[model samples]
Target: MRGPRRLRLPRTRAGWRRLTQAVAAGCVLALLPPTWLYVTTGGRAGTVAGAPRTDVAVVFGAGLWDGEPSPYLAHRLDAAAALYRAGRIEVVLVTGDNSREDYDEPDAMRTYLVRHGVPDARIVSDYAGFDTWDSCVRAKEVFGVDRAVLISQGFHIRRAVALCRAAGVASYGVGVADRHDVTWYYGAVRELFAAGKAALDVTFEPDPRFLGPKEPGVRRALADAGRRPAAPLPRDAGR
Candidate 1:
């Protein structure tokens, strides 16, 4: 059998220039999504103290530990509870994964928030928020949230804000602070790739994993807080 041909680099000057240009173009293409996220979410993310007063706050699930909210998730819930206690937000929409019977992120998050002083009645659970995009879509479609303050770690908040806005909920983001640990670094790197998926999600505006019938939880929670709920926006109103 003949041996395989050896790989070779471009031999001519013009060929080398073309190769360099191709590499640069590839880099630019890879960077576009993250750049879009940063620019679109500028001035929209801040500490909870500076977050805009919205009727609802949406907390995305991070993970759970021992059937409880993980430290990162607890920090998120803490911000939601603080917003409620400070009268900055009326309802806490805890959106997370509950696809299995044994692991329930939304319930764990709700329990943590309630323990931190948020009333059970004021917290709504979204059992199908399997990801950031799903949470945003469900917040608007199922829960009828026209505007909300999204909560997540700093590395992930810009993408959350971008996706929620794309999903038709006018959103401000409150990025919870955490120690600069290994998980923090991992999350930061993960956002670079997640941004690409986020760009596709906004561009296509696909349906979420689950788009069930509309729920009255958010409207009822607003009513309980003494605000007359505005009519829910049409599904495509954001576009």
Candidate 2:
């Protein structure tokens, strides 16, 4: 059999110009998703002190360290606790991975929040939040979280806010400040690619990794606080 032909570059000037145009177009196309995230989430992200008052606060899991919340995850939980203490949020929906028997992010997050002075009863756990998209979807559908203040690091808050809004949960994002460490840089770079997946999640509106029956955890938590779940608000209401 004949050997495969080697790849060739454009030979003529016109061909080179066309190739350059193609490359430029590809760069723009690749960046469009991240740009969309920033544009759509403009003015929607802020510190915990400025977070909009909402019935629920959704904290996306960062990671666990020795079955405890990692520093990054702890920061997120701390922001949520502050929101609760400031009376900006009522219920806290801690969503994270719990796929394995020993790695339980939601419970770890719940513990961290409780230790931070957030009442145990005000914390609801979503053990199936396998990713940002899953957490946002489950928050709206499974937990009936119509409106929320989403808590995550600054690098991630825009995507979180965009995904939650796409999932029909009116949201404001509380981007917890953190030192610009290696992990923070990694997370910032990672969001560029994650923005593409977020766009697909919005476009396709796929079912979460686990979409179980609607749970009354949020409602019960609200009741425990002597409050009724607020009426669902327009996605752009607080923006």
TM-scores vs. true structure, each candidate: 0.90, 0.90
lDDT of 1 by residue, 1-239 (tens): 99999999999999999999999999999899999999988878889888867789899999999999989998998889888899888999999999999999999998888888998889899999999999999999999988888899999999998999898888888999999999999999999899999999999999999989999998898888897443332222343
Give lDDT: candidate 1, residue 4.
96
Candidate 2 to truth, TM: 0.90
Clashes of each: 0, 0
Tell me which residue pairs clash in candidate 1: none
**Candidate 2: segments with Cα more than 4 A from true spot:** 1-12, 228-239
lDDT of 2: 0.89
lDDT for 23 (candidate 2): 99
lDDT against the true structure, per candidate, is: 0.89, 0.89
